[model samples]
Target: MDYLSIANGRVLYILASIVIIVVIIQSVLFLRMSWKRGISIGISKTKLKETVKTSAFFAIVPSIPIVIALIAISPVLGLPFSWMRLSVIGSQSYEMIAAKIGASSMGIANLTDPGYTAQVFSNSMWVMSVGIIWGLVLSIFALKKYQNRMKIVQKKDSKWAEIMVNALFFGMLSVFFGEPIVSGGLSLLVLLSSAAIMLFITWIAKITGKQWIRDFALSVSMIAGMAFAILFSNLGAV
Candidate 1:
């Protein structure tokens, strides 16, 4: 069996289309629910509408990397599976790592090996899907309780709650960036350039008093950082 033929088959495309439809339905339902809840809480319609617009903007903007990743990995994983995986989870690094590990386990040497088989493709798909199941399970079961606990903390001591939330945010950043930072060289340089781009955007937003532009800071910085990495790689600057 051809590896890519299986990965990008019509059956897989159909399945991916179904997932996309389900996601759209879910997004609409959640948006309606949130809008109603906001109205109930006396949030002005204008503010809520603005919030929706800003949210949509943010969603599309930050997805640049996911689109790039989908293209980048399509050669190894095929377009349909990569599209579906990124659309659902949006974890580019995790999916790539899972797929590579799966391929490695099959003794393929690497994802780009010419001798890849349908079995290797199947194994990679299974690994990518099953490895992320725990996060979904926790989201379904623990989210409500976690939300309630945070509310209680905030109600009791807002200052302490703020500190707790910031701590969580920074802790996540450290974990996410720790490995790449320690790897040094190109990864470290890209990270610094991205941070610099974000800081520059924040300064522009502050000095210009156009705070809305700050929302795109992450998107711009991420794309620019990727561009920088590509430039450095091509120029043999590492």
Candidate 2:
């Protein structure tokens, strides 16, 4: 079989293609924004850059599991229909067309034929392409809204709101992109932990006249720092 027929080869190629395309687009936008701002260190710039990079990265990251799933359903070249004759064509041979159609239909519901693999792959790729585009547009809109919001708030609770929204957005990305570290239990833990930590520090800063702002700043700093660290670490590992 050709390299594209191999599990790792085909899967990696699909994911890498998606990642490269998304990253290039995202990077160009990011560079344009950064250029316009002169690398401003305000809340929005930091948050936007971080969010775009992480979201784009994780978006492609989900493809790994997807590819593995595709490979699992494929025949083993010599063991055809024994395991799932209903889904296979012949003994020790793959029902290539059916498998393709099944995969392209996004979970094998509409694939009634028995020999159309290319159709499945093509359809699925088109679907994924659309999803990627939608995600990128949403990311851009979200960043714009966030930056606009940052320019208006100046009161004590403003920073808190910014932090909260950042957390929520990050959580959304985590949920949407299938970040493994943000599993159910871990998500709850991160939420409770960041909330508790932020509240405690903010309250202490409120009561004390000296460096309360500093303490609050430190708290927010730690949260952002830790999150950035965790995300980049995961990116490197992935």
Candidate 3:
């Protein structure tokens, strides 16, 4: 009857599991098709295998942050909803803000508060769902058009187009890099430590030609950051 109970119910877990299974199936199918296409295009088996290995390594790095996000959201949204949202559509920051807005609309302080009822949970779900729907809609309908426009721009001036793309990426990275500074204290330390670790790993990779270390540098840096966070917290540095 309550939000917590409904959020953690077996039925929800079953549904979430189904969604995850479907995603896994789709991913496997895509991978298989891509591999076959690579071979058909005259790509060697050795190169294809290396591509797969590199992709898996790169995937592990981003996935660590997603897993961390899942843990952060699970306490409020419960495992089922958190898993599904993060796995399906929402990023950690977006999902949290959406949930907060949803709860606030119902006059609740936060997801974990005593006043967070079933209705509040429903509101949060709706907000989170609707918040992310626009992105999907754009991807489905407008992404190709946007990409085609970019392609034209690239064709006109390849170097400028590359610079534009890099600028966009840098802008996005700036927001994340600046976030810890605004948060201050332990967060800032963690961010700096992560950056330092990543840089060090990159340097080592370049010097020693350790391709595997370069491939997994992001994940190692993230883990190092998380460890530093814990250390700082325990030391009352935050």
Candidate 4:
């Protein structure tokens, strides 16, 4: 069968649904265990319930963007694969970039480009999987050692270590925020607008003592940023 047909195939959807079901089962088990443990540790039932409520609320808010991203990618990669990838280890940005690289390597410009076949789709999936597999494997094997090394460095010079950690965070932030600015289009506007919304949300949360606002601040800012992007696109301002 051709790539487009495979993308929307029933078998793929069934497999993806099975993976999701497994994940759901695991999550339910973990939650049950954690709840029992919390009770054993003398946590009150009310407090435990509240904790679950807050977690569900916060998780739902952040997951909106992820769902949006999944929808955005579904057309190109097919619903089942895109859903599975995002639900598992793949971040939206990373998946998009990996798919582009995979397509380019196969002489296709992008995921949506013509002449893409089932083989091409398989190649793209392999590329995406292989690209991310190393980090997961390394973390499973070496993360504790890496963390221990950081702890040793911190013990040797706590102040210097703090500075180093902060620098690393800022450097990562710069890369994420700087790329859109360098691209100089709707992306730059979206970045700036999101930053502004986040700052405003933080300020209002602090002043108003609205804990819920603080909890949902990131989600609100991201939604606002997306709205601004749409408006700008409609206005041809970007």
Candidate 5:
């Protein structure tokens, strides 16, 4: 039946298309919301919808790059090692993340098993969903408590953080799913592109006149670091 092979190919195409489409849509919405509101609206309905869409799209999009990178690396390291290497990078992810959060590092060990990728993916999906809801709830609470000026900053930070967390979880999910789609030089190209996107997001957020821009800066760095780690471990010269 070649079920494993067939299923893997299907997943590659499905996830790739969904991730690309969602990212494009989210980017357009982001530009539109920023242009229209100019950091004034506390929370526009249009912006809210865009944020939600971006959050949902980001929840899984980050995984696509890793999945594709692994697929690309599968030839060099075989199926499972490519996946294990990705997880190893994630093991130290929380350490750097904790440091950013002003907390002591929490050493997370790599599961490093082929079967573990699926479990990690499942866990990430659950966590991302929960975080999105929590972030939204917190944003509402902040908006009510803070003044209008603060609300604008708070809203943007909240949405940006929500998207970052979603991206983080999706990156981890890629480790769990363990599908490879790219290889050779193409793999490296994709990894660099992913990093460029993350960097661009950080740069844009920082340059904006908004006050809470710093909050998003660190979060973007954290998310970028996590994704880069996975990409490097899986794609680096392998």
Candidate 6:
């Protein structure tokens, strides 16, 4: 069977389009509700509009990665599923890893190889969808209790609670930072370079009082880091 046909079929496109439309509708509804609530609570319309503009700008910067992710995985999973998965819930790392596992489990050595089949695609889809839910399930069942406990801790020892919260935040970030550092090489170099670029951009933003430059910091840093990576690789620096 031509699995790519099914993967990129009109049916899949329709399904993905529907899901995307629903998400957009929900976002619009939430924005309208929040805007109205803010106005009711005495937020000036000018301030609210500025907040929305800033938020939309930040949102686009983050989605640059997601667009790249969609392009990266589309060959393996096809455009529709990859588009839906990345647009909805799955990250690039998770989707790629899950798809690789699924394909390899079926004895496929290369996902983008021409011999990929419908069975492998189906299995990868299932794994990608199911694997993302365990953490969400834990949160649904336990997050409320955990939050209540944190509230109690905050009331009893505000400073300690703040420390604990910061620790947890950093712990969550450790996963993102740990991988590049462990890989050591271009990954580490790029990571450090991006950090430096972000700091430099931030300093410029502060010195110049340009809020828009601060808003562009992460996106600019990432692109510059990629350019440096290519230059380093060409120079045999990995």
lDDT for model 2 = 0.50
Candidate 1 collision pairs:
none
Q: In angstroms, give how far residue 40 of model 6 lies from its true place.
A: 4.9
List where candidate 2 sits over 4 angstroms from the true fold. 1-107, 110-116, 154-156, 162-238
Model 6 alpha-carbon drift over 4 Å, by segment = 35-51, 107-109, 112-115, 172-194, 204-216, 221-224, 227-238
Clashes of 3: 0
Q: Which candidate comes out best when scored by lDDT?
A: 3
Worst 10 residues of 5 by lDDT: 99-108
- Candidate lDDT values, in order: 0.85, 0.50, 0.88, 0.86, 0.50, 0.86
Q: Clashing residue pairs in candidate 5, if any? A: 70-180, 71-180, 71-181, 72-181, 72-182, 72-183, 117-176
Write the residue-wise lDDT of candidate 1 on 62-149 in tens digits: 6878899999999888888889889986497888889888989899888889868898898988888889789779999999999999
What are the TM-scores, per candidate, against the unseen true structure? 0.76, 0.33, 0.76, 0.67, 0.28, 0.73
Candidate 2 deviates by what RMSD?
A: 13.2
Residue lDDT tens for model 2, 105-187:
66545443343344454554445344335555776679788666666653547778779789889988677436435554444
Question: Residue-pair clashes per candidate, as listed?
Answer: 0, 7, 0, 0, 7, 0
Instruction: Give the alpha carbon lDDT tens digit for every residue of 53-108 in model 3.
Output: 77776676568789999989888888999999899867877988999999999999
Tens digit per residue, CA lDDT, model 6, 32-64: 999999999999997787676666765775688
RMSD of each: 3.8, 13.2, 3.5, 4.4, 15.2, 3.7
Give the poorly placed runs of model 4, Cα more than 4 Å off.
24-69, 103-114, 154-163, 179-210, 221-238
lDDT of 3 at 2: 71
